[model samples]
Target chain A: MDIPSHITIKEVGPRDGLQNEKVILSTKEKIAWINRLSQTGLSYIEVTSFVPAKWIPALADALEVASTIERKKGVTYAALVPNIYGLERALQANIDEINVFVSSSETHNKRNVNKSISDTLDVIKEVADQSLFTGRKVRGYVSTIFGCPYEGKINLDKIKKIIDSLLNMGIYEISLGDTIGIANPLQVEHTLEELKKSFPLSIFAMHFHNTYGRGLANILVSLQQGITTYDSSFGGLGGCPYAAGASGNVATNDLVNMLHTMHVQTGIDERALTLARRIIDDKLGKRFSSHLLQIKNEQVKK
Target chain B: MDIPSHITIKEVGPRDGLQNEKVILSTKEKIAWINRLSQTGLSYIEVTSFVPAKWIPALADALEVASTIERKKGVTYAALVPNIYGLERALQANIDEINVFVSSSETHNKRNVNKSISDTLDVIKEVADQSLFTGRKVRGYVSTIFGCPYEGKINLDKIKKIIDSLLNMGIYEISLGDTIGIANPLQVEHTLEELKKSFPLSIFAMHFHNTYGRGLANILVSLQQGITTYDSSFGGLGGCPYAAGASGNVATNDLVNMLHTMHVQTGIDERALTLARRIIDDKLGKRFSSHLLQIKNEQVKK
Candidate 1:
């Protein structure tokens, strides 16, 4: 199978990861971690989410984190914005890139955002247009594209419509998320095959979860499908708390390790990434999931 | 990439999984677990090892386990034998299949078995001859085929030589083991491409560890190479105790889940395998390393 020569990794640890974690990091702690992550040579770092404090108190200081971090020269410090208000907050904070998400499955869209798919699309259209018009890159996330907890087996037609809407709204890239980690390689291949025919490969990214231990396998197939951008979290942190069996996003460490070994350049510094992982994982007072990180740390102790 | 329509999984949990574990299951516990596994529809199960008690105190009751479990009609109960003495014990217990192992790297071979590769080969030649003459199948395992703890990269020439020697000595099949789990897809593809030039794919199996979290990805590539047989431990148990950072073997649960999703049949019952996993993992008083098994169990609890 043909694979990409190099891949871009968008690290979502600070935002997607911390939001699901029960242990809340203070503004200072989040800034420290994001700054450390910036030095890891990651091109994109999703710093925080600009959601309302009551909804996600964990990232209540998103504006502070966006303003505090000493952003690196080549890194794009990004933030998640749920609506026009969130996008306005991100703009004030001078976020490098703005991310907006909607679920492809109608049931998930209603459950997650309290809106219908069409309603969510309208909000995304406003958010995407404003972000792009303000000279900021807009990345769209289509959650539950593979399967849904509330509604299993998402249809391909839904994915295509969502992608077309996001692209027409000027979203620079769309991340197809396996929200519940219910995807298998065959399902992933089939989905990508259909999606690729409908969209340019340059505007696609894969966001997978390790909920079923199929994260890397899915990524491997995505690589063969000529996908060059992937969304991941450091130490594999971030999973929906409501999703009973779901784990974190595919660990950034594991993804980079596999890519490097396969001769696919990711331009990530392993040592710096581990240091950032240690800082956050230690602060959380728990071992975050990431097999490569865990094993390497264990060896160091030995 | 064409995948095989069906695959054979040789469950190595009882022997390899328990051997490396710190917790010791009593003879009765082992028998109970083995009996549960027999009903899982696995065509082959490596029950226990007949090595010296000092070498593996965990499997000291290998003879009793081999004799006690009510072996199912379709499953072949297998055992690991380190030398002629272990082979004799296996013979007395009427083990259906015998497994012998050596390392592709000389340092690892010496460290693992305290014998040179040539000397190990001589012993394996004897064991294979006797087992075949007695109408039993012999499976040879070439450990550290991809990477070694003491020696990082192993030569492909060494792998070819070992396979040739085993085949000539009447070994029915040879398993290429990534003992330290340092395999990548490109390297696996390259190694398999070179080896297949001299050997038939029918006599080969892939045994991978999840040390680097690349187990399933490696397995995916191997499946595409037409390898139908794989060795895995349930709950992802079994790692080299001597290798400092080695994790468990690829979990049988994860392997079957991936294979079945890819439309490849393994003829194993997921529910039954999970039942067997619960029995052994609860007895060990720790969650074993299979991500899929752990997540499912956690969901059931919720």
Candidate 2:
């Protein structure tokens, strides 16, 4: 019942979404999709990740995408920067915001980035400091905060420590990731309650996956807990590469629709979001996982 | 969070689920699926609808299925009875409970049952009386409580009047249905708050569809308002017959999985529900709308 009147939706379809996909979009296609996303009234868009081509070939055109997207005024264009080299590339591309991520679980952290949690933090510290020095705001992503596929339930203490480190390194916000999409509403409430005791809730964002159809439910609890910022993908694109059964991030269209229906202002144009989804759908030639997309498809059939 | 520690799930997959499908299951297959559902610890199952064969050929074998399923001792096998004639057949099938449904919107009621709201309630009144006189408890379903495809936003006063009429007719519990899957959490919270002012929350259940993927989110708000009973279908099976682009009911597997994860007991086995879904999947040869099914498919591929 205690929901925010307005919320911020950070579109992550281009980076987090396309990274896990098999089909590689041309640099021009990626730029076109981001341009479409920019017109959707989303204030923030993560356009691409600067990870190496060997790590995520689908997003290997990260520099091209980051540099070529038509950056709309008042919109923050972000790119994921894994280390100093990635940060250099993102900086060269003039990304508006730099996002660095590390997994909360040791096993998942090692498997994802070939580094321990501590080592990942060390790299993130350098990236955050460098980005801050360059007058660019940096956001931190703490993955597997809810549950890790290999290690199962993550420790809250570990998540707290990682968040603390990120905040100490001049990171402006920390996005908590449910990498395996195993979080329930109660778990989200408890975690947020604990985190709120340590830091202001405004400094945190919820990044959920809709694997078991609990993404919106989790978001509902987060809203009740005063979380206003959420990270979602267009048409529910992307899945965890390391977690076998993990699904994509929660769909941006579904999130915006729910928010608007509930009278929670998201400032998003649902019609425009669909247009962005169409761009990706055309390039990938695959069906998406979003319920809104299914409804649209049904309407088209009729 | 004020969430209930224990909840009741009324399984509607066999009746509401199959009735909307293009592929009609044989009576034997329906009975087998119901028997499998009985093993999953569901205390209530709406097995079939006793409508005229001309109206719903998919459920033409209703009496055969209702009578032949291997009913577990603690489970209440129920059936949908539209009129006195349907009630007679349901009584003959020895169903434990009778469910009567009417749409809150006038146009949907006319389109679905070819009768005015008043006339449909008149029929429901007679059906309820006969079923109660026969010593069978009757439940009521009020569809399109959230929004109607034909009428758009439904009037709460109209819904309240319909619910009052049904309760006056000896209907024990009323299941509030989002027939078009248009309800959001705030709407759910507001509606339940208003309804609780007139009736005890104990006498109401929430029935939601996943058309826009807001089902679980809506359920979260309902739970916060002390709604402990829900109607769900295995594998998200059914869609509204008259509502264009409506998706299936909120999946029982996803519902039970979330409840169990949140430590809210429904006494339902997730694995057993999956087994029951397999039966329907084999019979229909189609993928379901439930996220749990998608996750299972992903796991199987791995």
Candidate 3:
């Protein structure tokens, strides 16, 4: 297969990974991990979320994480904003970028953020408008774009509509999250094929969870679709707050491993990513979801 | 995507998954597991291998396991053969079908079976002739159809040629094996697009390992291509002799869970597979690799 020559992975572990983790990371460790990822030449690093402490208290230190991280010159550090209030908080933190999620599956949308699809979109639109007024770039996320645990297979027509609305609202790049992690490569193939009909590949990114263990496969499928931007968690840490039993997002190390093997250049260093995963897994006192982190072999380069 | 109405899984745990495991099972447990799989309604089961004990001493109990298992009416039992001599042993064991493997990569063939590509072809031809003389159906296996751990990426043209040879040798069907579990769904898509030009969907099946955690994803891609029959290990058992630190084949339990979720009909029973995996994992003193077995929520439908 003629895969792409290079890909961009926006590491989101500091925010997405920690938000759902059971053992709350000391704000210091979270900052340390994000700082570690910064030195690896990553262009974008999601720092934290601005949700209230009552919701996802694991990231209650969001403001602390955002302000304490060591941001490199070219890196764009972003954070998840739940609404206009969260967006205002993000603006106060002076973050590089902002992200808002509206799940494609209505059931997940309600359960995830306690808002109906339309209601969620309204909040997102208002927040996007406000962000635009402030000259801050806002990225839109459409989670469970392909399949959902509660709803089964998703309607991609609905997915496209959400993408269209988000794009029309002047949001930045949209990431299609396989939230429940049930989608396979075929789903990815068809989803990208349909999305390509309306939007440019540069406007789209992929977020996959490793629930059924298809994260890397889905990422590879996305790569074949000419998608350069990806969402990965360091040490493969991160699971959806709503989807139980789902593993972490695609491990940063694993994604890099597969990319380097396919002769694709991912500007990030594989060794540094591995070390980041090691720190997280050791701190958590549990194994990280990444298989690459578990096996430290020099043979990874070949 | 219009997923297939049904998918056929050719359970290969007894032969493929168990063979490479360091722990050896006695004839009684082997017979028990093989017989248990029969009740699960798997149509095709690779129950044993006929290689020399010196080569695969773990399966030296092949004869006893093959002889003692109570046969089910609709299930077709099979064995893997290395050469004509292995085929003779399978014939003596009354194996309903025999499978032989050849590599698309010349280097893999040489390293795997210690024979050149042409020499391996000659050997397969001899075995096929013997199977024809004995009125037994010979199923061929094209191993490393994806990238090989030893040789890296394989040429689709060479693979089509090897498959053509197997077809011309009077083999009934050829199962394409991803020996290294590095293939993504697109690689599967890319290869199937080429192989289908020469081989019909009915004449081809897939043998996948879950090493890089894409077994189910790759299966979804294959199912979309109309390939029904698949090879899986119980509890995701099995490891490649070539890929160091790679995990087991896609767990039979995990495969069934996914297929059942997709509203596809497979005769296999998920609960029984889970029970069998528990037995295997308990005996081995470690967590088994199957994703379904790891799920604690246990929505295991009968």
User: Which candidate has the top score in DockQ?
Assistant: 2
For each candidate in turn, the interface RMSD (Å) is: 2.1, 2.1, 4.4
Candidate 1 residue-wise lDDT at B293: 71
Say which docking band candidate 3 falls in: acceptable
| DockQ, prediction 3 | 0.28
lDDT of 3 at A285: 31
Q: Model 2 chain B, poorest ten-residue lDDT window? A: B278-287
Pairs of residues clashing in candidate 1: none
lDDT of 2 at B213: 91
**What's the CA RMSD for each of the models?**
1.4, 1.5, 4.1
The Cα error of candidate 1 at residue A212, in Å, is 1.3
The parts of candidate 2 lying over 4 Å away from their true place are A242-246, B242-246
User: For residues B123-164, what per-residue lDDT tens digits would candidate 3 score against the true structure?
Assistant: 999999998888889999888888887788888888888888
Evaluation by lDDT, superior candidate among 1 and 3: 1
Q: Please list the C-alpha lDDT of all candidates, in the order they appear.
A: 0.86, 0.88, 0.79
In terms of lDDT, the best-performing candidate is 2
* Shift of residue B40 alpha carbon in model 3, Å: 2.7
